[model samples]
Target chain A: DVKVTQSSRYLVKRTGEKVFLECVQDMDHENMFWYRQDPGLGLRLIYFSYDVKMKEKGDIPEGYSVSREKKERFSLILESASTNQTSMYLCASSSTGRNQPQHFGDGTRLSIL
Target chain B: AQRVTQPEKLLSVFKGAPVELKCNYSYSGSPELFWYVQYSRQRLQLLLRHISRESIKGFTADLNKGETSFHLKKPFAQEEDSAMYYCALSGQSDSWGKLQFGAGTQVVVTP
Candidate 1:
């Protein structure tokens, strides 16, 4: 079974602070994604990396950035955190197939003060 | 624009009762849909995919293009069936498996 590990289960940061959320997948999958899960809005994609050094902005990429220096690790970066950015963040990884199912990590619940 | 929609935010049902979670999507090209479940304190996992056409854990969903709906159904609900359900569409607009997810529905099964 594939395992996706998130660095944190709970995170707290102050407004205007920079934040980093790390995710690692053991299956050597080529695709990685970052999403913010909100109650009414559901999970909205922030950024995704299909390969090392390649990234694409998803629907809700504002206030967020990503890094994929290696295949197994993907990191989401908040250049300047705000209170509105507090939400549950999820990381997912998948193989290179249209029909492949995404494997998700236990999310990090972030609270920005 | 490609999008997925799960209309209900919460669904409460009794054990042994029939349960259905509605999911609808809007996409321009060929569509592939999937249902995901997240149990309490557990990571989200794939429950079933429409392309696979296989029932998982007694839950089955059929894609209806005319209705643009992929409603998940179970004949007899179990106590363990309670969870957060999400409907997702694989994005064809971009190459990689970027998914468009819907606002999830929370199912609660009571005795």
Candidate 2:
């Protein structure tokens, strides 16, 4: 069984504040992803890291960034959190192969006030 | 552009009735389709994939390239089978790590 752990299950932050969402995977997968799940919009990718120090922007990369200093950990950073930034953030990891299923964390419900 | 479309937002059926969730995709290259399910208060997990061609939890999905659709079906719906189902397509060949997901369908099984 694979374990993907998010730093927080529920988070609250004020507007204009910096926020960090951490994720760690025990599977040591080579690919890590950050996505925001919204109603009627599905899961939109924000950022993804293929390897340590390598990052790529996804569909909804604006207002967010990512860090992958190590193979097991990936972090999402919100530079200046706003009310609109509130969302359920999900972290997922997958092996370095084609059609590999992504393992997801429990997700963090973020609230920006 | 690659896109995944799950037209149905909600589906309700009796516990013993059959259920189906529709999914479609638009991509120029070969597509790898997948179905993911998220139970109440649980994380999302893979239900099945087109490439694997394996039925899981009594659920099966067939990839119809002619229709560009991959619809999930189950003969007998169970209360525990109720969950959010999402259809996803792998990104371009060069970017297989990325996936485009559908809006998802919430299934409700009534006793």
Candidate 3:
């Protein structure tokens, strides 16, 4: 079974603070993604990395950046968090194949005060 | 722009009743569709994909290209089947790893 582990199940951060959400996958997938899940908005992509040091902006990449220094780990960074940034963050990984289904982590519920 | 639309936010049914969750998509080219389920306190998992044409957990979905819909259906609803279902689409020209998802439907099966 594939395992996608998130560093935090719940997180709290203050406004204007830097925040990091980490995700690690054991399946050695080549594609990793960061998404924010919101009510009525579904899961909107924030950023994705196809390979180490290669990143692309998704539909909602503003105020967020991602790091993929290694194949197994992907990190989402919020340089300065705000209350609007509070949402359930999910990390997913998939093989390079076109039709491969993504495996998702348990998600981190972020709260910005 | 590609988009996935799941119109229902919540659906309730009896344990033995049939269930259906509707999903529609707007894409210019051929796209891959998927149904994902998230059980309470569990990670989101893939239920099925259109390309596979296989039924999972007693549920099946058929892709209708004319209508651009992929509605999930089950003959008998079970309490254990209650979960949040999300419809997702891929296969955009430039975005391979990106999936556009719908708002999701919360299914509640009453006993």
Candidate 4:
């Protein structure tokens, strides 16, 4: 079965601290995405990489950055964490084909204090 | 702009009752619609896609292009069926990924 895994299931960070959320996929999918899930807001895409070293900004990319040094891993970076940034972060990956379903990780519930 | 909307925030029903989750989209071209479910403590997963036209877990959805709506329906609700459901659409552009999700609906099933 295809699987996506996150580095942390829960995380707490202080304000102004830099944070990193790591994601890895075992399916060798070419597309990976980072999204923040919140009540009422649903899942808003933050950043996505279609290929290694290639990245595109989603609808809500402010206060976030991403890096894809390897094909299997994608990292979401918060330059300066804030209380408002606290939410459930999800990582997903899919194959190169269009309209294919994305496989998601369990998610990391990040809290910025 | 392409968008998807799931107006209801919550739906409550008794076990064995029918359930319907509505989804509407605003897109000019042919749209690819999908329904995703997230069970308690589980990751969000695809329930079904309009293109596949297959039933999953006794649930099915039909895309009504004239209404621009794709609603999910199940004849009977199970206690385990309670979860958050999201409707999504794909962007027609050249972008590699195709997921523009709705606000989501939380279904609560009673005994």
Model 1 per-residue lDDT tens digits across residues A16-106: 9999999999999999999999998889999999999999999989999999999999999999999999999999999987788999999
Better of 1 and 3 by DockQ: 1
CAPRI class of candidate 1: medium
Once fitted onto the true fold, the runs of candidate 3 whose alpha carbons sit more than 4 angstroms away are B92-95
Model 2 lDDT per residue over B1-111, tens place: 998999989999999999999999998888888999999999999999999999999999999989999999999999999999999999557354688999999999999
Instruction: Note the Cα lDDT for every prediction shown.
Output: 0.94, 0.94, 0.94, 0.94
Q: Write the per-residue lDDT of candidate 1 for residues B25-97, one digit (tens) a residue.
A: 9997888899999999999999999999999999999999999999999999999999999999986655577
Who wins the lDDT comparison?
A: 1
For model 4, residues B2-98, the per-residue Cα lDDT tens digits are 8999999999999999999999999998888889999999999999998899999999999999999999999999999999999989866735765
**Poorest stretch of ten by lDDT in candidate 1 chain B:** B90-99
Candidate 3 chain A worst ten-residue window by lDDT: A93-102
Candidate 2 scores a C-alpha RMSD against the true structure in Å of 0.9
Worst 10 residues of 2 chain A by lDDT: A93-102
Most accurate candidate by DockQ = 1
**lDDT for each residue of candidate 3 in A21-45, tens digit (9 for 90 to 100):** 9999999899999999998888999
